[model samples]
Target chain A: MAWFGRHGDGAEHRPRGRGREPQRVERVGLDDLTPDPIAVLGQAAYLQLGHFEALSRAASTAPTLEAKGSLSAAAGKVLAKHSAIIAELDSRGADSSAAMSVHTAAIDRYFEMVQGADWYEDLASIYFTSGLLDDFFGRITGNLDGGAKISASISSDAGSEDIVQLLADGMSKDPRLASRLAVWGRRLVGDTLLMARSALPHPVNPPAGEARIEPVLTELMADHTRRMDRLGLTA
Target chain B: MAWFGRHGDGAEHRPRGRGREPQRVERVGLDDLTPDPIAVLGQAAYLQLGHFEALSRAASTAPTLEAKGSLSAAAGKVLAKHSAIIAELDSRGADSSAAMSVHTAAIDRYFEMVQGADWYEDLASIYFTSGLLDDFFGRITGNLDGGAKISASISSDAGSEDIVQLLADGMSKDPRLASRLAVWGRRLVGDTLLMARSALPHPVNPPAGEARIEPVLTELMADHTRRMDRLGLTA
Candidate 1:
């Protein structure tokens, strides 16, 4: 289920720096190497929409007003980000609807595969699954420009930190829940990886002139591992 | 299940006019006559939160992206309004959490009673249920001043027109849906009235110095009938 193309032999190494500088690369323009901006943005919108749905569901199922409030706030942020992406797409004269349609089936299928049974599981899914996706977007969009950057930035900061904290707080109160959530986290990541590979566009030919997605995947996994450790889970 | 107090004998009639002018009345101040602003605003927030839940649910169930987008937009607006109401309560030194707790059971019960089965029903629920509530708020708050006015005004314009149009469009496409929705609309109003009467703070004693709530109920029902007419539903 690997979606990334392998780098060709003798690919140039680029210096790594921080603060939004496009990563240095060899053999292709970063724009050409990256996935189509429309597709990326469209997939982003679909994902945010999914987050909105999940948060709303969690809010309804939440046993307490405080939990419902927290979930509602998270959902609101997702909606705002989704709206910003749509506006960015509109400004670029891109057909957001068409782009969204392209990945809707895969995104919907992923959600169907990972429906949570309770509020805690829902929160776990958001904290782990969405956290990884946000980090992944941040990494992949590092080399993009213009509307792609704007759209990606809109989604890259999904405000899941609050949800993560909430989940952590919940687990802290009931340490036994941590073990169950650790298992849930594993399932979430497994389903996420499967979905990503199946849903995201894949490079057909050898990685020359195409963005090497392997490094991005590796970075995402490393971040996910750190997040799991923070949540008292084995990655 | 009636929550309103009776009007004092021989209370002078105030002339009705448009635009923010406080209505004229004899013997009682509007603020004294109205429900506590904090309570009203709190209930409004709860209702808006419910709308957010319903809209998000509808968006997920919607068959098309266009429908999902519309529902998302509506949810976003409700969130913004709820935030504004919360801020207003905060500025007034009212405890929003405490206020919200006062009506949580009633609001939850209302939702439990009027749960929508599908997207169209959800849309109708938003249109008829929320629309009537907004009108009732507007009528009751006509005499309120300052923060009370601002808070009520925030809730009074729930932006349900778009949802109403969505429902009307859906009904136009399938006329048979109208009869079903007409019945649904009746159930919505009945449940709403039952909830309102049960949840709202009632004046324990009869009419002396109490603002007349019967007139306001009559007015709300009349306006609701007009809205029903607009939707081509029999009141």
Candidate 2:
């Protein structure tokens, strides 16, 4: 009753973040050998849940009331998005929890490994990972039937808007923070990419799936680079 | 811009919890010599922020993803309400952070002392304190102009509906849980009352403030009783 229900056919998808204009949606020329719809929804929704969770933790430990206030709102927005994904699953007649529980272990593991040593690193972790994942999902969701509208409906800024501001503020205050966060920001991408790769179906014939995902991954990285550039950090 | 900017003149307020019709708002007619408007808003808003933080922690540690999903949504709602309060402060031309930061240490201290030993206890902690404080704030908010509209504007649940349901479900599954949580619920009230009392202004003649607050506290307790009754627990 709790975990086995698959209400939706699992094709649901949506984008998140500071609500940046999605990069060229039609330019990626990958084939339509898609993964299981439930896999996509479950993995995707759980990742959003993961971000919401991570952000919630960051908000709790945030040093300033202002940071707590803004970060909490951003975290709220992310969780609301996660709930919307679960609700979509429910509408499909899937047990929402069941749809997402499958990915709980992997998502939890990612959060555990990526927990930052301080607020700046934590914010950087949130910025880089959410930046990459949201862009990747924005593309995937864009391809889904109603995803474009859903993507458009969310706040124009990705949830990372505050992160970018806070990091910039911090880096400006202490030059060391900039260099250290740049390193941290770069370190985040490797795990983030691995997690993104996990969201896709495991390739039965490695090259076939690899060939399809390679271009998409490149776009995601490029998007990540752009976000880092906004903070004046190297990707 | 971030702190010390008072936007609203300190009259904004709202209620939260399971969408129960506010308990006898007309009947709890204690005198209107309330605490400073800014003080009330900051303390109330920061208290909600603290719950959001505490619940965020709970969701992170929740053993099951189902709990995480519901807790996270409830947390988001709380944070949104907190943000709305801040927005009201912003509208009044107040620095939301400066307004809230004054009570941050006090609110933070309460949260630190009241944290539960486990998820069940945590849920109960959320249930009891939010039940009590929301009722108190609801009373205060109801008395202010435009407050009822904003209170009503929020989701019918006090953001604790999920918490109530989850706790009820958990206790039924484990008799020991219900008993332990009942005890935990009682222990929570002492600290919660002290915190609530601290929210009001100090009087030159202490009995005057205490006199008005006594009846109000009584009503808050009755409301807590009603909420606890729902859980088949003693207040």
Candidate 3:
């Protein structure tokens, strides 16, 4: 593995370490690091500001009653697909791991929130709607499919029935139609981008200002660019 | 099982189903049924207002340094716990369901936003903290655990592993802790109650003044009371 060291100004460089493998070094303080903190903070702040604003706007302006209904239907379809996979996994008597647990925990949180007292108009309509876009984006951008693999790994049998597997099965019945879903997915992403742009320039950025997230923002931009190139889309 | 039904107004009762058996309704509409919209709306509005206000307060007055550390530690611990469970489940070869799949989709959305925006602000913190609450509520509420007892019908272990069996094995390592956990289940309920009071109210209420959750709230309260009494906590 290639290891880079931080120079005096925080720029990455080839640093000599003990033998072939480098002994890890820790920078004690922010000042001790070499990168410009202000620039880093600014980039981070802008990204968050943009994202939160986008989410707020997208959620707020969702198509209202029909939006919830349509989204719910899509959710149900998705669930059916996943349930089939889970049942198969159960039948196979396979093993699970930390990653599966993370997925489970993430899912558990979503369901609980949806069923909670606080689940409201905005979330049902906007948060979820825009969120669907983000989901598709991550999937397409990441260029992978694990739904089938996850399904095959677990038991969808009586012992381990999962909603995701159910949805996946349902979707597979008319898998070709799954491509039609791209229209809705595109709309969701568009809304999210709009919201992000609107929310980016607020007077006070949340969590921390831009400085806290510069590295992350930089990475995201790079990823976005890569994704765009892969998809033959203009960045 | 007991069934309750009413006309447009709260006072009128209509018996539409079978004479002895409780009727199973597929779904209930919130807006059309409520007699007093203002009260319901007020509750929703209150929740939204509180969440935003909390976000603001956290942004201005909360200790950023401590929050940063605690949030990271708490998230890590939560992730670790979930990972271990997933690992155990995977080892047994279980598949998740369609409902779980939908839930996972929602979770993936939140995760993307958090990671993409690298939000350290109040928004990210709120999402992270509240996610734990979701997990707690989901487990106790029977959403994930209560789907179906179809697993009991399985005659063979052709493609299945028993999660309970896995749990039992781990518990065998610390038999004393198992009993303690069973007993301490009451404390989890108590702690859940405390956290509910502190954090749940935010999501409960929203901006639109459309509080579409009185029945669920009442049911939750009643269930919690029953559990408390069963635990012999009643004075």
Candidate 4:
């Protein structure tokens, strides 16, 4: 759904005195200040989910005792920063049992596998990197324009033209692989939509007063379609 | 335990020209290069457990479509990488069921929390960062001379120095909060050690094979102790 390069502080060139929140630069939820609240909300939900994936993987597999300790400390800091999002979602009174159960089962299996004598380094690298990519993608997917803007910001030195070319080259080298990945990507979309539907069916309280979700949802869908078109993904 | 300043990478710079398998730049499992087979076994077991955690989280929580679609892809990658270690450990015919069950439960709990609104973002950041740190610590803990090397390296970089300062400052500014986080860190360590103890009572086999494990473990333990000393913690 989204794409962007990593955001290092010195890399962004957003002119001095822009007065934009610096934290927002590294971890921007959406790229633009679009007026469509629905699309913005959808995008927010999606990106939050993506970031969650990144955070969890990063914290759980710390290799050395020292590194693990440092990361645990980082985790505490990150949690403090993002507590608002959690509280907002919780205020919604969503039903998260099914998703939580499935997620937990998978982690258990991983713990079992790695704890065994069969673990290896190369596989560890692959698992770790690929997971990282997924999490980043989740963060930027809802609004392609915003994602592109952020991606450009992240790789301000090379910018989107270069990054997109890199992606294109990578994809071109393995067209079959890209196709396979696309199919998989579609499946994830489906799964996410299903989850969203599940969340919707529950009569959760709005973070603000009034359960005025449908209008917001409609606007979000429109923005998603707009983003898909921008990314040349919509047929 | 160790910190990497900008200068650290320069000192031990080994150009990857040809005919060198990275020269064991890291001291992994053993206390010394002289070798002590028993400790190697323990370290190897610990590494595998780390792998399992990475794989499970990547498979379940990775937001990317490709990563999520064929969970087997991640599984296959892990199996291939750890095949040797797996074989080595299996050869021992030890009972891993109890430990496996415990890990599975922990992972399950983690994933469940992730799926819920209560702790999604916090959990996500923790997971991904933890994976990166694991790789970093595993590789760097032993290549240096002593605690001075580690302190110099840790103090050299701005980011790491900031992190160290941030932790120290935070702990000092709010003792109650710092105590809570310290308690959390201790619990995580205890849980991990318990899992390792339960999973493999013996060596789990390193990628380098049985002959190489004891030395690696010895090195790892020494490095770990040094790092703990630097962090002002009891490991």
Question: Evaluated with DockQ, which candidate comes out highest?
Answer: 1
Mark the 10 consecutive residues where model 1 chain B has the least summed lDDT.
Answer: B1-10
TM-scores for every candidate against the unseen true structure: 0.84, 0.82, 0.22, 0.28
Ignoring the other chain, what TM-score does chain B have in each prediction? 0.79, 0.80, 0.30, 0.29
Contacts from the true interface found in each model, as a fraction, amount to: 0.84, 0.96, 0.00, 0.12
How accurate locally is residue B131 in candidate 2, as Cα lDDT from 0 to 100?
70
Over 4 Å off in model 3, which ranges? A1-224, B1-62, B97-235
Q: lDDT values of the candidates? A: 0.68, 0.69, 0.29, 0.33
Question: Residues A152-212, candidate 3, lDDT per residue (tens digit)?
Answer: 2211121112212332343466564234333322333434343222222321433333332
TM-score of 3: 0.22
Model 2, range A140-216, lDDT digits (tens) per residue? Answer: 65555555544442323545777888999998899998889778877788888998777666656565446556756
Off by over 4 Å in 1: A1-25, A29-32, A148-159, A194-201, A207-211, B1-25, B29-32, B138-145, B152-159, B197-200, B207-211
TM-score of chain B of 1: 0.79
**Cα misplacement distance, residue B16 of candidate 4 (Å):** 40
Model 4 lDDT tens row, A214-234: 433343345434433332343
Model 3 chain A is weakest, by summed lDDT over 10 consecutive residues, at A1-10
Ranking by TM-score: 1, 2, 4, 3
Q: For model 3, how does the per-residue alpha-carbon lDDT over B170-216 read when each residue is reduced to its tens digit?
A: 35665654454344433334333444333223332243112323333
lDDT of 1 by residue, A94-180 (tens): 888887898888888888767766778788887777777765554444434564455355545555676777777888889977888
